[model samples]
Target chain A: MTAQPDQRITISVDAMGGDKGPATVISGMAKSAEKNPELGYILHGPEDELREMIARRRGGQMLLDRISFRDARDVVTMEDKPSHVVRHGKGTSMWSTLESVRLGEAHGAVSCGNTGALMALSMMRLRKLPGVTRPAIAILWPSRNPQGFNVMLDVGADVRADATDLLQFALMGASYARNGLDLPRPRIGLLNVGTEEHKGRSELKKAHEMIESFADRANFEFVGFVEGGDIPGNRTDVIITDGFTGNVAIKTGEGTASLIGDLLREAFRYSPLSRIASVLALTSLKRLQKRIDPRRVNGGVFLGLNGTVVKSHGGADDTGVSAAIKLAFQLAKSDFSEKLAARVASTVELAQDEVHFASATQEKQEGS
Target chain B: MTAQPDQRITISVDAMGGDKGPATVISGMAKSAEKNPELGYILHGPEDELREMIARRRGGQMLLDRISFRDARDVVTMEDKPSHVVRHGKGTSMWSTLESVRLGEAHGAVSCGNTGALMALSMMRLRKLPGVTRPAIAILWPSRNPQGFNVMLDVGADVRADATDLLQFALMGASYARNGLDLPRPRIGLLNVGTEEHKGRSELKKAHEMIESFADRANFEFVGFVEGGDIPGNRTDVIITDGFTGNVAIKTGEGTASLIGDLLREAFRYSPLSRIASVLALTSLKRLQKRIDPRRVNGGVFLGLNGTVVKSHGGADDTGVSAAIKLAFQLAKSDFSEKLAARVASTVELAQDEVHFASATQEKQEGS
Candidate 1:
């Protein structure tokens, strides 16, 4: 469909979501709007404060035309209980953003607020897409392929998951790969300790069997099991796992990048001669650093929700906030949610039929 | 406690470990010996190949009194099954190295071979330390702390674990911190989904209660739950988790470092002007990189073992091998096994008695 003259994809951004808060979130949205003409935004926070930020950015005209305001008197602190905050603190920018999605006023909601709160409220308010029991937070991870951006799901939504949840995550992650990244037949792998068909925890094995049963009809290529190290190896385009494992992996990866950056700094400071040699090698070093900067891949889209929920890093700065807004716009414009809902509904139908067939076959075998 | 004239600690080194095996292992040992006089080594591999490498370094006669040799016929490939290769290939360098530890010729074995094999062989040969149902490989992670390393255990040994295993890991890790890092009283934390005591998988809650039960003993500080991000936060000295989680975290960290290094290289390749800015910032970046290089902190001591079992990174170079050897020496001279065995044995005794007393008290209450 061509762009609707008046029906813009209005995104509600949690202005007080990250470490940088309203200032950086507003700045990022302003920068993002400079490049995308069709994107519109609604700043969800204290109205006066958000307006001040917009005025400072010289975005008064855009604010008047495309941007509006949603006043949230309360802000969710990092330590606030997710359930309580989402329940009692209805005025929080995070809750307000999700409210916009629920009210059909925005195409998506983006926030760098308390992760647990965003997840809790999004699931509580927007509800999961039909046939998806648990919605996953999907992030594009650094991969070995030069152009690779491997999609990983369930980063921190549902910690204790079953085989069915894993399969749902796979379907959702595949939809993201197809609809968000615009790829055909994204290679999907079940994240496990080993690649063998029989390897991995019992839940993973059951999930594997379910995925295998639907191999013919599933949207993505089932590439079997993948190990922890393979996430960065870029061997598969989409990786599926429970939220607990994915969250740990993502945080570990971030911590490691910070550690390596620290190490490189120490290596270059060995001696005056060594420092000079490092300076000479700066051209090559910077080439590598920019390719894997966390800032470039800072947002995780909460998939399978009725509307999009974008999660920026808890430690996001202005640059990262900008990237998150751009990411949210891309997801909104791509209209991946509708496509994801359809794909999930079809997959669940196929999985249920397989379950029924298996039971029937077992009964027949017993009768014989 | 002075070096007993006859109480020597011989550690077997795998000459054929990693991509650069014999050359790097040999050079690393040479470098290690130059720094530690009390350390002795028994390099195992093909006689001709090892001698050729040793000759290139110094033509022999240097540290000959401190080092010896053992010959093995084959090498373990990365893809080899730990169980089959360890059981069937006794004459291989990997097995021979473990054999030295088993035969009491060495206090510990250091290998950059497949980690799975080393962990399997160590358990099968030396047996688990008293009350340690399963052994864990503990890595001394480079921290932002100026003091030294953060100890993380079960770095890919046990895939599935119970609360009991976590308790055992915490005790073993505490021993390492107290003896290895010389922490008088180590701060211990359970790696969980969140810092909240109840915010993790069911097993985490049980583990938390168990750790708290021992808080009165005052052997170590029970810092309760720590999230995955806490590993790099430098908040606790010892972080304990199951092998699957630890392994994934460690590998994710390594892969992230590699990815960041790649990104930095790309940032500098944009243009000459950018290259100059990279040069100006090169010193700080180099310092950061060296602070987290896997080579500098390569050796991960497999704790909860009758004897020291140092599991080197499979992709370790010479520097890594040397670091493993050095760690082996420190572990050996420190008489870690005796301390570890005593602590485990005592902990088990305490736990058993506590259980028995609790059951008896419950019976009396029921009778009343």
Candidate 2:
């Protein structure tokens, strides 16, 4: 788990979990292998099928040498309930993928399966970190920041989060940003309906005070409250909210992006002159697409767990899967999971002290 | 306030409430006057300033003939708290604007003011409809629907909504879509984090059942639960949620759109060839911009109230203000408030009956 330059970082892959099947997964692995020499893989699925798919690739022999296979008989479908999967998914590729991480055979796990099921199995196998009540799913959003992305957490890990849970998210999110994005001191903002002190639900106001109280000790700057508009804006490095709001916000962002993309395509096909202009502007447009492409920011890292798990998009192609792999490699290289755990553990103690202090202050006030 | 072909529709204007000065409001009124000969305005602000601005327009004399002035010396700034404004804001233009509607002097009102203040002032002045506990702010989102937009409600009206409040929102939203958008039977969907039955908060689950129970009687098709993406998607015509989630989703959508637009402009300005292409694509690009322009969908109608109030964006310029005026005119002409009141009143009785029946059923089960 040490970040030694010469240490090999192996990623556990659930090859059969994706919509595009194992070929795309194998191709993504090959792409990752071509870029990094210190990377290895533990491909989880039916061993023979994965072996044949890897052997048929362009640099099949080299890829075969770096990849080891684990035979898993079952494939977790998108429709399978997370609870059902947890009880009966022991033989699945997703389970085996997390098992590799749990057994210390791989540094991290990547799965392009049902998100709910993946999180369920992940929690079942890896368990929650000490004092982590709700594990968060953090994703990188394309932003106008210097790092070119902002991290948002609890994007559908659990539908609810209390004041203390939100404080935990702020600490964990700051840690992820620091290690994963190379920011030494990240600015964290609690997401609310308005930036005003009196707005939003009462939990947000309580969480705001809790997060601010621990900001200095946690090595992150508290930017106070931010709105949904600031999620992709350059105002903050880490945006923290309960899973319900974060999930809706990110999906709404994606839906808006997709709608605009569709509209742009329709505009280009409006006339022959516009079509010609599209051809002329193809390179610039491609550059723009590359900059804002969801594929480039593919992984949703599951934080506050014993091990790291990167949930790739269910419909991800090779390019998308490769992006997830790159993220997993970066996180593993930085030992992000361990760092996040340590950050959360220390903050939990701080949070408890603050709670006790607050009640004691109230008691003194009452006595007076 | 019956819809009559020859009756002139007057919209009360809060001239000093917007980020821009009274000049922008006067210009917007002039634009509306130019388009519709039957539209009149009760301009609320310092009388002399509004008069001078109107007189300075191109068709000064003609415009002045249809406009009336209300002298309110104070202005409500964005920083003003809603509670403070409601208690001490009698002399403000925002209060005067709603006063016109309350006194039946104007058919509807439009203000580009602080949203919280507007809604608070509105509830206090106009009052809520019978059996309506929480009034909602419904806005039109640019979408793929045949009508070109979707209606989402409770977009920061209040921070919270219980199951019954959500049911009222569903009924009110359906009425807005039917009368405002000219849809006879609209489709209503409750917004949640996911489309699954057991995915969101317990209140959402309760709201789902309550909403479904009244769909047929309310004259709208219940599309069940919808995610954040469906806010702008074609699956539903009206999206209903608590103010907190709806507020975040819309702002997130707007932020994502703004980010893509800035990136697109940067791409087009990248090189000389791209600049040439931008020139050629000007018409098409403008067409695209016009299609999704936020100004075109500028008004957020405060539903579940006795009178209709359209809250324009605080930063709205002349075009945006004009759009708000246009919506106010449409709703006034259609007697949208009357129709919505009728819809909610009947649904309220039905809801009471359902409650009684449910209790009766439980009694019968206990007896058995």
Candidate 3:
């Protein structure tokens, strides 16, 4: 079953969910296929439209040969609620895309649909792995680390996560760093308002003790507490926080970057001399852009689930979509989902032991 | 007593608190005094050092004439806990600084010390204004708005904020915007993961409804919910959230900006041609830097207190301290604390009525 050298690793793509529709998704697939010969697609959409769009392309036949179409009649809109989608989205491309992964027909799934709906459908179809309470969405942030990026988790999966959930995120995030970024024992840090031990919420304090107790057993270094400024700093390789804080931090970073970019553009256009200088500095500026380009690290991988799912930006263009597909391909090739599940399963007993020990200690302190 | 024709608005300065020491604080005061002839200072520190530093300056006589000294034997270190400071910090310069404001000896107080200690001392000394449960720290963020900055509150005053606290932050933030940014009708937005009504925590949803209901009475346009990206965008003049989220967001923004600045510097130094180009674009880059300079917006005003207290950055230099002093001078001259108190007092009854109405509606819905 595994010996066909010419057979490419397949990625299930919800072709109808993005802002630019099926054309951009197909163009992205084509772009990825050209770049990586080992990649193929399980295209989910209305079969006729998708086939027609692919057939109209320059390398249509080659793309058509590698791609297989699944006829999904319905499309999930950006406005669709997660509950509504889970209840009635079976005929949608997003549902079909995850179905391919669930049925083992594709290695991983990719979608640019509504994030909530995508996560909901993913949880429903693939289900959580044993001992996993809440699945998290992990994304890569450009950083001063030697690896050039740091992994941050619980980006926007849920608005709440308790101390136990944060512990799980730390375990899962460290695993992702190992598999995705090739770090053997990634250093993890809990995000707080300050680096001081006395700062942040009570739950953070609990999580800190729990994470520290398990760091040696888990085979990752736990750097006690990290402030938001340390997210892009070189002190740690993985940042663990609740979804609400992580989501806001990432978006704030994006907004600030966008503002700086706009200001840089305005600066270049300010005067004739500056405009002339822009020409000479074009190469240098492009180098900087490439280093921090959001598209290059475009996917948010849904972790702690039975299957791997990458959620691309809703308004993603072809290049952005291509980056997401590339991420999916890498995860699928590495069997990331299975490895992550194994990591969580192996540590469940240790996690439970820590929780019980913590309560017992609290009880003793109160009794005293 | 009314100020005489030659008399100036006086500010209480915690001269010994910042990382740069009392010399930088005095330099900042002198700089502010040079530009503002109608400004004076009540400098708090050891009398001998203060006099020596002032006498060593170029315009020492003029600075000496405008300054008065208060002898304080102790200093609040950055590592001191708020509780410890509250108990044993009576002899510190920070305490002396707030004392001037409490005794009506100065119009406002400014400190460049530990934020938590300053806040604890401020609450203990200045006291919370009537009807205020939790005081907030509001800072200005560079933005696309006409005013060039947006006001965000509860940046790090306290870690938690309930729905009621959020409503108060909204009122206080809007008041700050009106006085700080001169926006007669500031547009306020609740910070959340998404703009959708159904998104975010239950507290955010409750705050959203409460803010909306009070918008007309509060004289602000409620923009409903705004994501983190809108914090710097022109869409909202005030972004309201709990202290934990706001603190993380602002720090993340700063970290991202610092990363881009470093990258830009590296880009300019990449090659000889790029270096030459940087020389030509120097003026344009400086213009951009000036627009988003953190030094220009260097103070976090503690709102919901009996008197004005501006917290400058702990690591602020002379220019940064000067900017903070300028902010304090402006707030003191405009009688911002009194105006804000009046605004809060006027809306207290309305707030109580809305809270009652909300609970009644909830009870009715639950019964149905």
Candidate 4:
């Protein structure tokens, strides 16, 4: 269940995870393995497909030992039922890959596929932390703040949640800040309708009180409510929210940024003069575009669970898949789970009692 | 209260209705008036502030006869409580300006100060459409769909709403679409967790069914449920939700869009090589940027009320204020309210009956 300080980290990848399946994943893994000598990769998917893909991208037999393959058949689609994905697809590529992490055959798992199914399967297999009713997906966004990255949690794992769930997400995100990203103490801000206490919905208002009251347990600076503008503005190191809003906000941010980039490209293509100018400025513009490319931060960590899981972009190609594998390896090599567990365990005894008390109090208030 | 088809619609600008008060509002009004000569303007803020600002901007008093001033002692602040602004500030610029619309002195009233207070006063004075419960604030966003502008209602007006309230928002949005925006039969989509029948919170689920079953009475297309991204991507013309989610989504989109624009500029500024290219690309980039500028589409129309009240940007300066004034005048000249009323009247009886029947059916289901 634990790794020694000098032990090499192993990662299990669902090679058949993305749109291009094992071929693109193996190509990326082969390239990454050459770069990271100490890293080990377990490619879990159909035997023939994994072997064929690996052979196509192989540098030779010398690099072949760095990867080992396992057979897994079923593939979960975006339209698949979450329950069905978790129940019927136990022997599937995604499920077997996640099980490797749970069984400690791998330090972490990476899947570039259906987000909902992955979350459900991971939760069912690895189980949620003791005080955690529902886990959250935490993403580190490159921020303008003094901190290089701001960790935002509950991206899409749980849609409707209570105050306790939000508190748990904050705890998990703070742990991630320290262990995964190596921040001293992440400054956490709850996403709200406004900065004021009187802002946001009744649920958020209630969650704010719990976050403030239990501030020390999470071991992060509770910086109060942050607005949507504050996310990209880099005013805070961590933003916490319910899954629905968080998912929408993240997707919107991604979509808008892409739209702007496309618009800029079109703008440079407008006229002959503009095109010539764009060609002249291409170097500077390219640097600028690279600064916010989501591909640079290609994976979201599914936090507050038993083991680390990195969810890559469903449409990611070889380069993006490589980035995700690198990220997952980095997470596994770090003291992520230990630090996360200590943070969660620090307040474990009273976590459930507090949650119950808060929920009861809220229910009484609403009922009255 | 309708103008002749050939009559030129007039709008009165509360030339003191923004953060900077009269100087900026007047400047904006003057610019908008110059752009559209057929649109008559009546400036109703402090006379001296308007005169000084207009003179400074080299605007001639050519339209002096068309403009009028109604002096008010106080102006609302962005920080002021909505209730306090409504109760104590009877003679405030916002109240007096809205009075002009109520009494038909102007077809529409534009105010950049105290959006909540403006909406409240409009509701109190102009009154709601006979069968409507809660009025909503509808803002149009540019979309990729070839069909129509995306209308997100309850942007920040009603904080808490029931199933019936959302249903009313749907009707109001559809009416506004058909009459004001000139969509023959607007398609209404409920913003929910998913497109599934059982998706989203219980309240949204009930509202979805009510909307679907009420298709007999509702003139618009009820396209079932839609996810958040669908709202801004131009998938649906009319998106209905309670104020909480709608406000969050709109703010997220606006802030994120602006943030991306800022990042894009920063991207181009990264190096001298790109700077030259950016210069060549400037004109086309500017054209595209204008297409998504927060300032150009800053005005939000408050719908379902008896009169048209346009809410301007809280932080609006002269140019943004001017854009809001122009938008308000255009909507007023269009006589949005009369059009909305006629549209709502034809479907009111059917909508009301469906709503009652829905609640009863829901209660029976819940009991079982």
Candidate 5:
């Protein structure tokens, strides 16, 4: 179940997944394969069906040779529970998809399936890294930041995170920003009720202290606590919160953006005059769409696992799927998972150092 | 500090608060006073400064005559800590403003000072109602619900809420929705990471059970758990969460909305052609802006206290300040504070009844 980060070049794709079935998934892989020349896929699902679908949606025959087939007998449905999946998911494409990462056949796995099932199966199979209590699901949110997006984690990995788990989330999130967003020294902010030090849960206070103690050694700046309003702004590059808060925040952002998008479309076509105006501004509108499109930033990276897993939205189309593949491809290229594991390990060591140094200082004070 | 709901009518104003000083607060009062003939103000701030500002921004002679001044020397600054304000806030306008509510001189108080300071002072002076562990700050958020907005509570009252505290939030939020949002029977949803019964924090699960037990008696539909995306959608009228989560959800919503708004503006003016389109669709754009304007729905009502306190944003202008005053006016007319107190008392009773019944069952089982 162990593999060197170097042997993980191929990206595994769950082929018979998502709402659109194999057609959209193959189309998406073809799209990513066309763009990323070195990209290869260990396509999961019934082999004959996938080959047919990929040929139908083929961008180029040369790209087809890069694909290898892994036949899976079952597909995880949207209605399936995570508990059910964990018990009865032996031959499912999702199980086999992540199994490729665990067994070193692929560097990372990409799936457009039930999030709960994917997370459960991934956790069960990949297992948590050393010094990692709980793995986190980190997503890149569109923002007004210098990097154009902010990284938020524990989106829905687990419902609760203790103080130490939060500190680990901070370390993992910062590492993701460095590798994913390419930010050298990301500013990490703990999400809270208020920016004040005394505000929020005691867990956050403990997390704040823990994260700050390791901030210097972790190579990230601790921006202290940030309000939710800072998520889409340039206040911090990484937002660290428990899975419960992170899950709600991302969904709320998506819902708000979707609502605005619908309203804007209705506004632009409210009348014949407005319709003509929309036609005139079509190019500008498309640019705006591209800038804020959920599909463009479609992947949520599962951090703190032994291997990386990228989850595309369940309802993603070909464009969205391609974006998810692209993310998986990027993470697969770098030793991102190993680096994340190392970051978490070092942060824990640094925290223990701070505690040891503090006790020593207290002894010195008493001696004097 | 105890006053009957009958003695609550006049709206108290903290005139020296907000970024615009006394000018906007005075103007906002003038605006609200003009619309509601029965509405009266108990102005709290420096006497001479408020009088001078009133003279400068006087809307009508009738509005001016309706205003009654309460002279005070201190003004709470944004930099002031909540703890510090609680200690040395005797003569501050924000304190005096809520004191009016406590003294039955006003039914509700409106202030644009710091939220932490405002919340802390209100909690200290007004005191928590019977069986209420903590007070919650409820705000109206723009939504696609039938009422065009949803009531979300514990936005920044306290950072934590245990199971019982959350059930109290549900009862309080439902009552606020009835009076504030004017929904007779608002459906209440406990905010969680997921809607599944087995998902999220154990406190939420316990809160869900507690709230469900009293739904019929409370006369509100329990919509179970809701995700953050539901805040702006029509799935429920009231979303209840601990203050920490609620505050983050709200600010994140505002941040996302603001981000979309700026990007929309950029899109509309991206080119000369689009500029012409913008000119053509100016009316539609204005309509859209009016629809999502935070100023129109501009106050966070502090609930679970003996008296109502409406906190206007620190930087709110005349329009936003007026919106806060208008909400105070509505809640004051409805005997909301008394009704809220009653609701908490009754819900606490229901919880006790359930606890008693559970113990009785255990006793019977043991005897058998």
Candidate 6:
């Protein structure tokens, strides 16, 4: 269904599993609904507890009126393993949450529970798209681009991905930039150790050529290769790498940013004069903090799945939860799930044939 | 060559190849000499240029008395590839500089040239240590530990490393920590995507058991597996991974740190109030900047080679060049080369055996 400005969009929320419980989740939903009045939500939890909470609403009845309920007997705790969740999670809030998407009762699902569990449940219920080998976790990283962020994929979907998988990531990431970031001609880059013609593992080289071959029909410009140095910059709109490399890169960037932010605070408070300066510069500092805050960039979109599922950070409060909900809303409003499915299904065979032929020829040359 | 306090030590310097030319390299050496007067130098470059530059150095005849010139007709530029350098780099300053260490004319060598070129020349001229299939490039990362830094290796020596290579990195990194950082027993960690017991790829699991078995004889504690979040923190003294992961981690950390640093500066200059605050906080900001400056941590040590070589940044200025020199002198003074060779020679075979045995047992179990 196409998004009409006046038409209401329904979203599914797993309210029982977040760190701050339903209090923060409901508050975040109210804040989001204040700006997006067209939002209707399917709240997943024990209906009795949620009813009491909704009855005690601080805001007017507008937000309360938009919410509906689905009863899930159990909650998926943070300690639950992905395998365990998949095996025995039929009645749980997390499973019930994604079931809404599968049943077409909601456009998408959002959760602030364990990442592995969410991905498992989503993949099991929603299923992988046709021709998709491994689903990827894509997030928008703050960048020097005019759009203020860039797409990096397979952050922690799985630990390993082959050359073909990386090629799929490049295609999916390009589609993400086009639909999510609204870039007309998104540039794709394969992450490697160096930008030179001859560097990194054989898979990266293979993926480089694979991505280059498919750029024209895929409707994205392939910019050869980029290093980790390019991840936070504006040089490329999309970066595709294995889950291991991408995961480590994301955590490393976040760790370094947190360390620098801590040091900056300490430095600004070093002396009385500096303390006064800090007070004067508080607004500017807060602006920078808001711009780079991980809390503001909460959702990790599960790409290549039949239905979109956003995993919010486990410790996310109201603001983080709201940011994640916003991502889910935009994706749902744009009919992103259908667009992504069409993009992958239409182009998969062509990309696969190219890779198979390239590898076969490479094997022949090596044998000779 | 034990570290006797009063003994004079020699350090070889390639006074070419840096972006700023010989002026910054020489100035850095002079600064190091002022702090450590017993540092004798064998400066390599065109004799005419060196003689003119050294004569102009202040503090007069005393510093000059300790300096000697090694005439070289050429310089290895930043654009020079490693293969090209190995073939046509005989007379270049970078080649001549490392040759001095090979011939035992100097204890250690330092160059602010191309990293790929320097590693190529050093490996070719100096050779790998016994039992070492690969040599790693180790760098001192600023950390939350009281020692203020940690060791991470194989930054970019090669794009790939196997289980056996990772074992060697752990040993060599431990030695560098012991000799370079003065840690009696450095804690070594295997870098992976997760800290869970049964996460990440098979090689990581194999390496984990391998490192554990060698800890007693290697004389360093193994911290099992660590994620990228621990890179800047005090979790482990040495983080071991393949060159691709290590290189990306370093670059991603640097990129993120730099982006935050740039944002911090802009925050302090946003308005008139913040501008005044910037003036008042200038000294503190400078202190913080110096604390995390990449120039201050300029050298990446080439470990598991017969002799020590430090790769200063190609874009390093006076201060960066000096930091690299000081590291070389310290390694030389401690006889780091001999210690490293002994460490690798003694420990590599045992770790290799452990990996093979573990894989065999696992395969047998699977068949059963």
Best by DockQ, which number? 2
B1-368: candidate 6 lDDT, tens digit per residue: 34457778888999999898988888888888888877988889997877777787677456668777799988988777889999999999999899888888887889988888898888888888879888999998877778878899889999888887888899999999999999999999999987876888888898898888889999999999998888888899999999999999898888888778778788877888878877887887898888789888889999988888998987788889889989999898888888887788767666568689999999999999
**What overall lDDT goes with each candidate model?**
0.79, 0.92, 0.92, 0.77, 0.87, 0.87
Clashes of each: 48, 0, 0, 3, 0, 0
Tens digits of per-residue lDDT, candidate 1, A52-151, equal: 7677667566655678788988898878888797678787888888888888788888898888888888888998888978888899887885456788
| Position B254, candidate 3: lDDT | 92
lDDT of 5 at B36: 71
Interface RMSD of each: 4.2, 0.7, 0.7, 2.1, 1.2, 1.0
Please give me the total number of clashing residue pairs in predicted model 6: 0
Off by over 4 Å in 5: A1-8, A58-63, A345-368, B1-9, B58-62, B349-368
- Could you tell me which 10 consecutive residues in candidate 1 chain B have the lowest summed lDDT? B1-10
- Tens digit of lDDT per residue, candidate 2, span A1-368? 44567889999999987899989988888898899999999999999888887788788999999998999989999888999999999899999999999999999999999999999989989999999888999999988888889999989999999998998899899999999888999999999989988988999999999899888999999999999999889999999999999999999899999999999989999999999999998998899899989999999999989988999999999999999999999999988888888888887787789789999999999999
Q: Please identify which of the two predictions, 1 or 5, would achieve the higher lDDT against the true structure.
A: 5
List clashing residue pairs in candidate 5. Answer: none
lDDT ranking from best candidate downward = 3, 2, 6, 5, 1, 4
lDDT string for model 5 (B200-226, tens) is 888888999989987999999999999
- TM-score of each model, paired residue for residue: 0.88, 0.96, 0.96, 0.91, 0.93, 0.93
lDDT of 5: 0.87
Expressed as tens digits, the lDDT of each residue in A1-368 for candidate 6 is: 34567778888999978889988888888878888877889999898888788778876367768988899989999788899999999999999899988998888889998888898888899999998999999998988788878899989999889988998998899989999999988999898888886888998888888889889998999989898888888789998988899999998898878777778889887888888878887887898999899988889999999887999888889899899999999998898888988999879877678779999999999999
A1-368 per-residue lDDT for model 3 (tens digits): 12144567899999987888889888888999999989888999999988998999998999999998899999999889999999999999999999999998898999999999999999999999898999999999999899999999999999999998999999999999999999999999999999999999999999999999889998999998998898888899999999999999999999999999999999999999999988988988999999999989999999989888999998888899999999998888787888888899989976678689999999999999
> Candidate 2 falls in which docking quality class?
high
Going through the candidates in order, their DockQ values are 0.41, 0.81, 0.78, 0.51, 0.70, 0.69
- In candidate 6, the residue pairs with backbone N, CA or C atoms under 3 Å apart (3 or more residues apart, or in different chains) clash, namely none
Candidate 2 deviant stretches above 4 angstroms: A351-368, B355-368
Model 6 residue A171 distance off true place after TM-score fit, in angstroms: 1.3
lDDT of 4 by residue, B1-368 (tens): 56666776677677665777676676677677778776776666667766666666664566565577777767777777777877887877788888887788788878887777787888887898877788888888766556425787888887777888888788788877766567877788988766767556788888887777765566788988877767656667898887867777777677677756676677678777767667767787888878777787778888888777788887787678777777776676666788777766766766667678999999999999
Chain A TM-scores for all candidates read 0.92, 0.95, 0.95, 0.92, 0.94, 0.93
The residue-by-residue lDDT of candidate 2 on B125-149, one tens digit each, is 9999998999999999988899999
